[model samples]
Target chain A: MRRHTFTRFAEALPAAVLAACSGPQSPLDAGSDEAAGIAILSWVMFAAAGLILVAVLALAAAAARAPAEQPRWATREGWVVAAGLVFPIVMLSALLAWGLSITGGGGGASSPPAAFRIAVAGEQWWWRVTYLGPDGSALFSTANELRLPIGQRVEVDLTSADVIHSFWVPGLAGKLDMIPGHVNTLPLVAGRAGTWRGQCAEYCGGAHALMAFTVTALPAPDFERWMAAQAAPAAEPDNAEGRRGRALFLASGCGACHAVRGTPASGTIGPDLTHVGGRPTIGAGLLPTQRGTLAAWIVDPGHLKPEVRMPPFPVFRGEDLRALAAWLESLR
Target chain B: MRRTLVILGLLVALGAVGALLFAWSGLYNVAASVPHWPPTRWLIEFGLENSVETHARGIEVPPLDDPALVHAGLGHYEGACQPCHGAPGQPPNPLVRRMLPEPPYLPGQELRWSPAQLFWIVRHGLKYTGMPAWVAEHRDDEIWAMVAALLRLPELDDAGYRRLLASGARMPAGESARLLAAVGPAGEALVACARCHGLTGAGGGAGAFPALAGQSREYLMASLKAYALGTRASGFMQPVAGALDDEQMGRLADHYAAMPTPPVRPAPNAATERGRAIAERGLPERGIPACVTCHGGNALARNRLFPRLDGQHAFYLAQQLRLFAVGTRGGTAFAELMQATTHGLDEAEIRAVAAYYAARGRPR
Candidate 1:
């Protein structure tokens, strides 16, 4: 009985790990049509590869078991032509066709002409996502996080500020390189409402591993509401602590790099933090957005993500840090 | 053996020619705009890691738990290191971020190095990287202080760090103009005094600096003159005093003397008792005189030049006593008297007396 239990646990271990991988961010958990198509292609390739491996192994084993003196079914030349040339050509052609069909079937043609469009700029270790209004002007700006409406095709215009960086949302769309001085367009449609993960596929610098973002696909109405809220300036802090924090933020030279929309923090050096409080993560997805984590990040961003642009504030202490954190959180 | 040798020689010749050809080809991209190939990058990183690890081995780390050391380090870091390394709640300069090998933010990076390795890297700096060596080579103590601060950096929040920076002597606002006016010919030079002595003359914490508040105007003036005339030797204070004339010196002395003194709050413990005993009673066997004879509040009226010791930082008092015993701190003629009085007292006795005086009643 003990052995049986141990065996069961051992067998279940891999399945358990695989199950854990099916998180909101997992590529295997396809929440969008694009991701599902990729998944299907992946399974097909896996099955084909498995069959090829089994066939090759079986042939080798059968050949070894057969007597050397036994007559061959066909000459060595015939076998080589059949297995290496003909088999590969047929299988590869089929796989290529499938891949082309999946990729060539662009989501834009099927979607409405008035699709939501966003421009995502890849920085050294972060994403600068801007939503565009009808007139092609930026409606609002956010960093490290992208929000899309479910069942709506969205076009993302990708570009890079410095070195080359590839934007990849494995759960939503294929990887696309964001090259400096060039813009690449990627259209994605989320068939379901869920959160997915996006990461910088290219190695940009010291913090490339830490460069990640969340893609939350909400219902059409909810996404519109979120966009509207993001477009507005940050609300006035409600409490005395928050007010003090806002003052600290301004006084401490935070406004010189980050923007809070309504505030005088109109600097363009860092991310737009107008609706930062509502975001699920901060520091380019290096940390979850919580009061404690936000405070810690403000205190020392380099600690959380090495080589980050944000400097630590060794000058703020106690009530000031708390107040600043509260005020930032209240931005939502 | 002959055949092997010939083949080896030919291979070496061919390898050299190949290398020469490659060097002259100009096919290798040397652009800073692009990163090295993965293998090349890995090799360089590997070399750096091993070199740092090897050189950092066996370095004895000093006890870095002292808050005072951390405070001092924070001050130095803010002024010198913060531009590139950055502190909590600030970002590095934008131009600095564009460097090829970007400087890592120290808060998270501090954990990667051992305290001793940090010291080594800080003092010697990494070769080929933008990190610079320490300007003051002999100040290992200051470097250690910085290491101490780095060790605690991961745990410190912005507020905690700011508090550490603010722990030292604070300058009083609205007094610079008055001070400048008081020392007419001195002009802006008087402002430098506040950097160490503070605008209110309260001194840095725990007597790392001496409190100038409530000190006799005559003593202050005499000390400045001694410093100016080379009668007293202090590497830190001599330069400032040497630059001033007698009138300017007198005005600065008066300015500090007139400033309001801070309240005394000494730690009360067994040390305080021993300190009080040493101050009140003479060590008859050791031929040590009671401190009250010269420095007590009761004796202040008799000698106008005697500096008031009450409510002064113990650290400063103990340090002065040690300096007097060593005959390095030469003050006015009365300094000899201090040397003689302090000659017989041991380090512990001196500490006790300093602590006692530090906890004594406010300066009259």
Candidate 2:
């Protein structure tokens, strides 16, 4: 029975591994033009590697089957010239040129002009994404999430607020470093409208492993609508509980580090919360955005994301905490 | 050779048994009157001094020359230390001299030990002796203040001592009669508190004390209970509050809470603009909350447990904030929030915020 189970597991393992290569976060999934080019380059390299493996295996097989003496064609000198010396140089040089053509065409500082630019500042363990207008003025800012218009090349001006962090969206483009005091640009052109997961590729301080974001590529009209909505002030809470929560939030020190535009709570230390209710995740994608998750986050942010700068509000309890979280969720 | 070795081992075992029996017999002198032999006394003294020196090695002493700090230390010394360790000219009571390990007179102590060593000894008192560890274990600031006074003792004559203590108000005579005449029935049990806080709770002795008048009843009660439980680190208030029963604590809280607030001190110079900014808006970039959100007079914050900061002494507020930064200022359960909030503030910001609050009068 155990042998049968092992046989089944071995058969399924290859399929599972292949499946893993095509997910929301997989480079091979290739949601953007840049990523598709990378995918083709990757496949070509893999094919070359497979051909080399087959040739080496065939030579070994022939050597094992042949008599003690080998033929002149299979001698050390002949193999060295064909496989060892000539093969690597030719294969590597080809792969390098191909890889460069794919990455360099749309990558680096001197790439073609983008339709619009966005500024992404890497904080300790979070991303502060600011959407810029055509004139380079900031339209609105959000945290840990990016919204892009599909089929249009959007340039991302990346820099670090504190330390070095690498911005990586595997399905969109290659990773780029966000170095402190230096701006590095990454051009992204989404070929399809979908959500792709991104993560901090570099090891920042504590909570870096939890620092993740999502890029939503939308149709131009939808993207425009999202920007307009995000730029507007937070809506007034309609319910009594939400109104109470707003009062409690200002009364408690939530306004000190987080800002909700067009309110007395205009703090710039932490993320903007004008459209927090529309977000799919909070705490920089540490938890799914919901009332329960939001409440847990507010009461104990460090518990959810270690070394978080936001202090815990253990004083909020039961109905008060619930009301506060609901009000925040209603901010959209 | 084997027989001889066996005999030697037996002899060693026998000696061990004999020593055990001797200890069990209880024939040795154990009375306080019967002083230790010279060797035993030397060994204990050696161990005590060495232990203090070892533990006190890394303690960094702050500047102790401030006149206000020395003055405040003198205030605590008069009530807490003088009774046991005796001042320069005043000898301890005749009965106190009879204790097993007698407390030493504190004058000229700097000649014998460094300020750090004295701090360690005072903070963690002699274990076997009658000397008790400080009531508030987390309050190193208060203990350091005491050390500053101890360092000054060798030079202070009795006249100087009296002069330094002149600012500390004396308790009124006839407890009930005076208490009734002062702040009414609530003041009846506040004789010890009034020594520094004054009868009406208008804090006295420059900025050394914090004014308690016009504070909320809930805050006052919580503070008193915290001190009694030793959660709040104040060596001065711990023992006083610990001695009071629940009812007495309630009355004391009520007494101070109902007392009318004193007139606001004149605002400091325009240099406090930085402080005003911090108090109103906070250093948001550093993740520090605005002091006005909860403690401001204009905030009208609903959390009654958070004490009113307006008109409080700037020096006292600044010192408390410094203590909070180091996680040494233990207070009510909500105080942890202050610890988190103040963690990012620099020294200049702390001073500025304190000054802003101290000059602002009366919580609305």
Could you give the CAPRI-style class of model 2? acceptable
- Across A245-318, the per-residue lDDT of candidate 1 in tens digits comes to 88877655465457799986654547888988999999888888887888999877888888776656755689
lDDT (Cα, 0-100) at A128 in candidate 2:
90
- Compute fnat per model: 0.00, 0.46
In DockQ terms, which candidate is top? 2
What is the C-alpha lDDT profile of model 2 across B1-364, one tens digit per residue? 9999999999999999999999899988788888889999899999988998999999999888766677678878887888987776786677768777777777645458899998898798878888878877777878888888788887888888877764534545675466656544445457677656666676645566777888888888888888888888788888888787777777777877887765555456698889988887777656677777777544444567778887887878998999888777777666877887789678998899888877777322
Q: Candidate 1: misplaced stretches above 4 Å?
A: A1-21, A107-111, B1-364
**By summed lDDT, which 10 consecutive residues of candidate 2 chain B come out lowest?**
B167-176
**What are the candidates' interface root-mean-square deviations?**
27.3, 2.1
DockQ of each: 0.00, 0.41
Model 1, residue B291: C-alpha shift (Å): 55
Residue B165 of model 1, lDDT score: 62
Best-performing candidate as measured by lDDT? 2
Model 2 lDDT on a 0 to 1 scale: 0.81
TM-score for candidate 2? 0.87
